[model samples]
Every structure is written in C-alpha cells, then in structure tokens.
Target: MNKKILIVEDNKTLAKLIAKKLQSALGLTVDVAYSMAEAKLFIARYTYFIALLDINLPDAPNGEIVDFVTEKNIRTIILSGNIDKEFRKKILKKNIIDYVNKSGVDDINYIIHAIQRLQNNAKHKVLVVDDSRVFRKQMQTMLENLFFQVISVAHGEEAIGMLKSQPDISLVLTDYNMPVMDGLELVIEIRKTYTKNELCILVLSSNEDEEITALFLKHGANDYVKKPFSKEEFSCRINNSIEALENIQMITNYANRDYLTGLYNRRYFFDTINEYIDEVKNSGEKFAIAMIDIDHFKNINDTYGHDTGDKIIIALADILRSSTNPHDIVARFGGEEFCVVLKNINQYSAEEIFNRLREEVEKFSYHLKDDKYINFTVSIGATLFNEEESLEENINAADMLLYNAKKNGRNQVVFQA
Candidate 1:
C-alpha cells in the first residue's frame, strides 16, 4: 500500500505542490488541511502513516497542531515558515523526527528523505496509559514519527489488559493522576507481577516539582516527564530510561545467578517460586517440589577438606542442571542442599524425576586439586503441592521426604504421602 501523508498547511499552493511532488517522487497519497480543525477532522476520518505539519496554523498557533498530530500516532515532519530559532529548538527537543523551515524544492525533497528514513528505522512499541485521551494521543504521535507501534489506553485497567496482550511492549508511558487506578497504583500492581526488566515505566505529571518526581520514582517508575514538556527533552529522557533499564536488567540477571551451578541462586529461586505459586493459585494447576541433599556431605568435607567438598557441590549442581529440562526450576537452595520446582507435573512424574536425579548424582564424579577423582551420591525427597497448601508447608513436606531418603539408606528417592 502507498504510504498516506497528511499535509497540514495553510498555503494552498505550497500544500498542493508538496503533495504533487511527494505523490510523484515517493508514490505517496497526500491529504491537505488548511487549518488545525480540518487536520484533526481528517485525522479522525482516516489513518495517515505520516503528517507534514506547519507549526503555526490559523486555528491553533504555537505548535499546538504538532502536539495534536503527535497524539494521533502520526509521524510528523514540521514544515513551517516560522523562523524563530528558539521555537524550532523547542520543537526539536520534543522528539519530532525532523524540522524543515518553509523552503524550496530541495527542502521538500529532504523532507521526503526524512520520511523514508523514518520508515526504515526500527519501530519501538509503546503502551501509553492515561485517563486523558488528550495525553495518550500526543504520545502516540511523537512515538509514531520515530517509527513506533503505539497502543494507548484511557485507564489503568485497560492498560493492564493491553500489556497482557502485547508482552513485547518496549515501554509504558502513564499519567500520574487518573480515575480508577492512578499511575503509582498501576506501577505497584505491575511490579508485583512483572520483573523490572520485563517492563519499563515512566510517569507523566503535569507538575514537575522535585517532590512529585521523587514520589513517582519511589513507586518504581523508571523516570518522569513533566506535563507541557519540550518534545526534544521528552525524547531524550525516554531513550535514556530504556538504556538504563537494559543495564539494570543485565546486572540483576548476573547478581541472581549461582556461580557454580549456572542455575538460579537462592534469592532468585525464592522470588521465582513465589511468582509460580501466584500463577498456579489462579489456575489450580498441580506442581511438585523436591529437596535434594548430598548424602554424607560432612564426612566428605572432613575427609578431603572444604575444597574437595566445594568441587563435589559444583559437580552435583552441573549434573542436576543437565538432567532437568528447561522448564524445570533447579536451584542451589543452600550448602549441599538444592531444590527443583516442576510445573504442570503430578506426584508420579515428580518421583520419576527424583529417581533419575538420584541415579545421575550417584554416577557423577568430581576431581580434586591433587588430580584425584572422587565419586559422590545425593538423596532426594519430593512432594506435590496442593491448592490449599502454603509454600512453607510444601517445602517442609519435601524436606521431610528428603530426610526419609537419608534414613532409608542414603542415595535414594522418597515421596511425601
């Protein structure tokens, strides 16, 4: 399909000429609007891939038209006769893709090149949550010009559903003050379910006061942009916020990873288990937990020193990690202790996995610094989590089963009744 371009220009001759050139050169179908009102009407009536806009129009001056176009999710190139350097600088700050002063044929050609560039660049996906339709539309425009797929919701509830539907959303721009659920409340709810890396949030505020900014940041917002914000400045802040989120996520993944096992650490394990419980609670799906302990670990530690014990632990972790499927949650619970939480599996399958792990652990060998080969074994206890059971109860049941394995001669697997 040929790209649609809306030309918001008061000069009929210029508008027609630009439209002709764009249609002839770029194979674009152009729509002309002599005023902001007509432009808005055209916008509501049809979807334009891009908008060629003049900062000043008869109905609304001072780039209000640009703001309107931006809200509509239309990529815009400012085509204006206005020569105020300060004003142009201000619009550039708002993240409008490009600004071209009213010029000759060459400038129009440059504008077409800019539009082509916008089409070729990567498209960011933004979810805008705001009670105000006005605000949502504004962000939609700015984002579209930068080649972003934009989804806007008028309230927090709708925003949540939208986020659930589009899991790949790159960022969310939400208003601080709104009906039903406000921005801070929304952020809190989202954080409770999703990781900080999974979603990047920015609070929009009419008030740019330090207290207000600090309050939103405290509530887990990535950043804040004041209302009546300069376009260029808002763009810079959003880009920086995304970069910061990527860095933070990288650090978080490393910090929550076990050094020896390459599995999740105790902290990440706990966090993930809780999240799993939350997910299963709503679905009533059956899950299993297993507690594993290296049998006679203390004797090994005393006989070969702590270094040998450490090598054995690392080797055991590697065995368990390689034995389990990707869906399985294997973690070094602590010391010689480890745990696995299997989802969508019943007690029988859990016991089978437990037996397999026991056999693997028994067969595994480790090497000490003196190049001496050492063999070790592990005991495991498994339990099925009931819908009514707490995580602690589930853990206790698994631990008790592990104790039974140790009691019934080590290197065995036991299941809770």
Candidate 2:
C-alpha cells in the first residue's frame, strides 16, 4: 500500500531531516511529530504504514512512546541515542521492527533501506510450511508484518498442493520436522518444477546440527535458518534470497525475450513450441501456427525512419498480445515479423480469430509527432498443424502461405485448411 509513515522524534531537526530523506528517497507522504502528544494526534488523524518512534520523548520519557505505539498495534522502529546492549535487548523484546541507534546519517540510511525492503516485500508471496500450528502462526505473523502475502500450510504434502495452485509463489519457508512429508523431501519435490533461480526454498528447524544444514542445501534448499531466529537475521536472509531470484529472472528475461517488443524471442518460441508438441503428440490436441508480418513495413521505415518503424512494431506487438489468449504463444520472430500458436482450436476458428486481429490492426491509429495519425496493416498466414509433419515442416508451409499473402495482396489473413 502507498501509505504514510509517521516519524515521532522530539528532535525537530532530526525529525525534519528524516522526513525529508524519506520523502525524497521513497516518494511517500511522511508526517513528523516533535513529541508523543503530536504523534498521538497524527496517529488518530491518519493511518501510517509504520511508525518511527524516538525512545525518549519530551512528555513521555523512558521510551514510553514505544509502549503507546506498539499498544496501538502499530508496527514500530525504535530510535534511541542510547546504545547499551541491555537496553537495546529490552527495547527489541517489544514488537518493534528494529532498534536503531540515532548516531548519524548512517542510522537514517538504515531506516530508508528498511522502508524500501518493506515496500519491495509487498510484490512477493511467501509460503510458510510447518506442522505445528503455533509455529505456523508465528511465521505467518512475522511474514505479514514484513509486508509479505503469506500462505501457511501444516505439512509438506499440503504445501505441494498449494504450490501447484499458486504457481506465482516466490519463496517457500519450510520446517524439517513435519508429518506427511519432511522439509528435505519437500525441497526435492519442489526442485522438480522450479529451479533454484526461479524459486527459493529456505529450511527452518530447531536442529542445529551441521549435517542437517548440508542435507537441506544438497537437496535444493537455498538456505537454512535455525529456530528462534532474530527478526533481523530472518529478514536479511529472506530478502537476500528473493533479491537473488529476481536478479536471475531479470537476466533470463533479457536472454529469452525480444528487447524491443518484450515478446518471446525466436529461440525461446521454438523451444517452448517443441515442448508443447511433445506433450500433445499422443493427445491429439488441435492447434494452428500463424506467421504475421506488417504490410509494407520496409516502405514505412524508408519514409519515416527506423525510429518510427520501431514504434509501429511495438504498437503491433501490443495488438497481438491483447488479441490472443493467455495460453497462446505469441513471439517476435524477427524484425517486422511474428509468430503465434492458437492452441486447442480448429482451422475455422483460428482463421476467424486472426481475421478479427487483422481488423483490429486495420482500425488502429498511431498518433504521429505532427499531431496527425498513421494507420498500418498486417498480413497473416495460418495453417493447422499436421501431426505427420515435423515442427519445421509445418512452419515452412505457413511461411509459404505468408509469401502467397504478400504476393496476392497485403492487409489480409490467408488460411490453408
């Protein structure tokens, strides 16, 4: 949620600096309070994402502000000039996110980083697996406080089923001691579907044995956390794993996607289509392959320059994307050309679908730099896949039909039934 963060500090200078830093860095609305009274007023007036509370306020001394804020069920971060270990431990015992020593700019930087982490955590969903209801609830509470969408399961078998249903899960936090199946077995099973870079698996257990850690890691666990983990440790590990996963996926996308169109590149398209063919070879699922190219694309590039040509390409990609089913494969085969697989469809229906797509393209307009609009059209050639033919052979037939469409006339769909 894009919400406000409340800063309750008795130091006006420090509070304003924190507010400014937070506002500039995160682009979030921040309210600064000079004392506990002012903080209470802000809290009653507005709901905050999280509250940053100073330990010793002008009116409420001895870190009483922490108690008041936490009692209100607000997630808090304690800011104190005091750095005594015993005092820090006592303050952290409360439900505050972290105890920050207000030493200087570094402490302010820490707050910024923590807020950014929490914001990024919102885009991720974490699965919590534990046989014990108490532990499950505990992990769920912690994960939610850290801004994750959490789904907790009692054991490995249920976790597997949940993962199947929720394929978008980013990470799994599983406990080793569980019924139905253990964490190690869960790790092995999950790895069959998702790779280490695609999904992260973290094992949590009371067993501090080194062998258990090795066993989990060897079996595909990304990392291991012992029982009674401090909030900081847990947060760091979880965020690190997710960060790594995102980085890897980003790199993979760059490799497998067309940079300009954001569609599957030719290499990935063929690879995916080949896998689909293998899956449906025995099932007799009908599909159609289509080759599409813009009408007179090179002439447009010559008249308007390649920059405008790129814009036209991107616009056509959007049309193709919105016009197709989610399960359908749409890829940018190359410059000014694309490919699509109409899955679970007959020849007649596929022809109708492509004709509608062609109509949508014909009726579309791209506004030019001179306040004028330019209209473009495309020619599509489609054919039903023949089980007797190889993937390359079927594609070649579609390509020949595309040539015929270009030869006969552009801006139309040609289907070879």
Candidate 3:
C-alpha cells in the first residue's frame, strides 16, 4: 500500500493546500480532517505514516490531538499558529517529530522539508556518542523520533568500534568531552577512513569557545550543534547535513553507474578493478576477469528492432547481476558487452560460475509483447589474473578467449586452464 498522511487542521483552506502540496510533491496520499472527531474517525479507518496536527482544534483546543495520535504510535508534527516560546518548548518536549509555527509560507516549506527528511531518515543509521548517559539517550530518542535507526554509545571509543562494525552508519553525533577519547580526536581518526561526503559528523558541545568549534570543523566535523539548541535548530542542522550527504552520494552514483543497465559503467569498472588488483597484489590473492557478450546481438537488433534488442540486453544484465556474488564487481562495458571481476576466485571456480550463468540464460525466455517472444544466450571469456601481469595484458587475454569462444560456437564459457 502507498504511504499515507493525515493533516488535521480546522482551517479548511490551509489544510487542503498542505494536502495538495504533499500529494503533488511527494506522491503521498493525504487525508484532511477539519476537526478532532473527523481525524479520530480517519485514524481508526487507516494507518497513517505521519500526522500534521494543529495545537488548537475545535474539540481538543489544548493540543489533545497530539496525545491522541501519539497514543496510536503514529509520528506527529505540529502545525500551530502559536509562536509563543514557552508553548513551543512544551510541545517539543512531548516527543513530536517537529513543531512548525504555521505563521507564513516559509514555515509551510519547512514542514514539507521536515517530511522529506523524515522519509530519508528511514534509510540512514545514526550513532550518538556522549559520556553523559542522559544526553546520549536524549539524542538517541530525538534521532529515533526523526525515523532514524539510532545507536548510542557512552564514549568516543565505543563510537569508533561501532563505526568499524557498522559501516553503513551515515551520521555520527558526538559530544566534545568524553572519556578515553574526545569528540575532536574521534573526528580526526574518522577522517582517516571516511571523507565528509562518505560520512557526516556533527559535534555537540556546551563549550562556548570559538577555537573548539573551529578545531572540530577543521579536523573533519561536517557541522556543530551547541548544547542548548532548540528542537527546530537541531532538526534543521541534522537534516541539512544528511541531505547534503545524500546529494553527494546521488552524484557519485550517477557518475559510476551505467545510464541504461544501472550497473557500473566501463570507466568505473576499470577504476575499481585497478584498486582491487592493487589490493590483491598486496595480499597475494588470485582473481578472475570475465568479458561477457550476448550471442548474435546484431542479428537480433536487425531482425526484431533496436527496442527489442535493448530489452534483451536489459534482461541479460539482470541475469548477470543476480547470478554473481555480492562482492563481485559487475559492469556494462557497452552495448551487448559486459565485464565482471570475481575476487579471490580461481580459474576453475570462474568457469563454473560463468557456465552456470550461460546455462541459465540459454534456458530463460523473453517475452516481447502479446504472443511475441524471443530467446538469446551469452558467450563468456574469462582469465585468472597473475599479479606479475599488467591489467592490459589480462584484458587482452580475456578478449582473445572470447573471440575463440565465438569462433568455436556461441553460448560457451572460455577460460584459460
């Protein structure tokens, strides 16, 4: 089912506007409730991913709806016209995702952004490191409220271990003062492995020293949050940092991936394989490089048309991706041709893998349209790498083997014994 949202605001105009924007921008199904009773009925009928509640409803004037939705375990963000500092503080203390003052267009835009951030948060893991157990727990709760998977450690040492074990962690929130290692030292050490684009580090400190903040940023911290930060400011900073990282990642992915097949492009394959070769050279490990080509690809394109040929190529790419191990590097070399690097594998294992893949492709059938179908197969040529040989030499060997495979017959695995 599509994720749905609920907007409970007595102002019919503003509520519908918010709903419309959400529907158009995020493709979310939004249900608008003009009163607390209507919202209750909607809540009972369908599960909502999040709800935007007004502080003063006709029936629940004192933000009673916040409690009602929270009781259902639905995430809540308040859209109230009240900008009173004490009231905002009180509402923020209630463990809501965010409390937006519905006073202007910018605030509504903020609400939209917060929702987007929340959606992205589900894909990220955050690590919170602090010597104070209370602060660590507090930050963890806040991060969790933003829909992030949060792990809290009591000190910087533990944080380092966590990062080592959980390489998927996207953000680290650490305190300045800690036992064993401080946040600054942790940032310095983390920078040794991960760049700012790869991992986001945010420093949280009560210290008012400018040099301290500068030091953290100079070392590698992406941003800093003062200890007594407001809920809105904290949420904004965290989201901004995460969003920036995501943008960088998206650009990197576009650069590395083939536009059509979504596999690593030829350039990326060479770049990555060079590094892999270097690592293998140091470890004295054997690897295999395979060059794959679809058999009779030009004939298929000339007979069935280029569109159908494209479909066949896509189907074959899917097979290559699924048939290989996760650690293997798969790439689209160009039209109807592909390459893969199988790490720590001998010639025997490489042959077995490619033969299995060829069998699967030969057995598989492709449907073009209603009552129309086509079938295709692949020819593979692979070579086990010798650390002493150059990359160009290994590639040439694989290409020669591939040519021989085509010369003998199609749908075969050719490799050096």
Which candidate number maximizes lDDT?
2
List where candidate 3 sits over 4 angstroms from the true fold: 83-86, 101-110
Better of 1 and 2 by TM-score: 2
Prediction RMSDs, each to the true structure: 13.7, 2.2, 2.1
Give per-residue CA lDDT, model 2, range 232-317, as digits (tens).
Answer: 78878998998899889999999999999999999999999999999998998999999999999989999888999999999999
- Residue 30 C-alpha lDDT in model 3: 94
What tens-digit string does per-residue lDDT give for candidate 1 at 1-417?
227889999989999999998888788788999999999899888998888888778888878998788777566788888778887788886646777888788899888776655554344578899887777788887776577688999888888888888877878899888888888888888888776677789887887579878877887788888788867677667766666665776788789888766778989998998988887787778888889999889999999999878888888878887878888899987799999888788778878887988888777677656677778888888888866677888898889989998999989888874
Off by over 4 Å in 2: 71-74
CA lDDT scores, all candidates in order: 0.81, 0.91, 0.90
TM of each candidate vs. truth: 0.48, 0.92, 0.93
Residue 86 of model 1: what lDDT? 83
lDDT, model 1, position 380: 87
Please provide, for model 3 over 1-417, each residue's C-alpha lDDT reduced to its tens digit, 9 standing for 90 to 100: 238999999999999888888888888899999999999999999999899999899999999999999989889999998988888889988879887778877877777887888988999999999999888888987888889999999887898899999999999999998889999999999999999989999999999999999999999999988879887789889988999999999999999999888999999998999888777677878888889999999999999999888889889989999999999999998999999888888778888998999999999899866877788888988989866679989988888999999999988989885
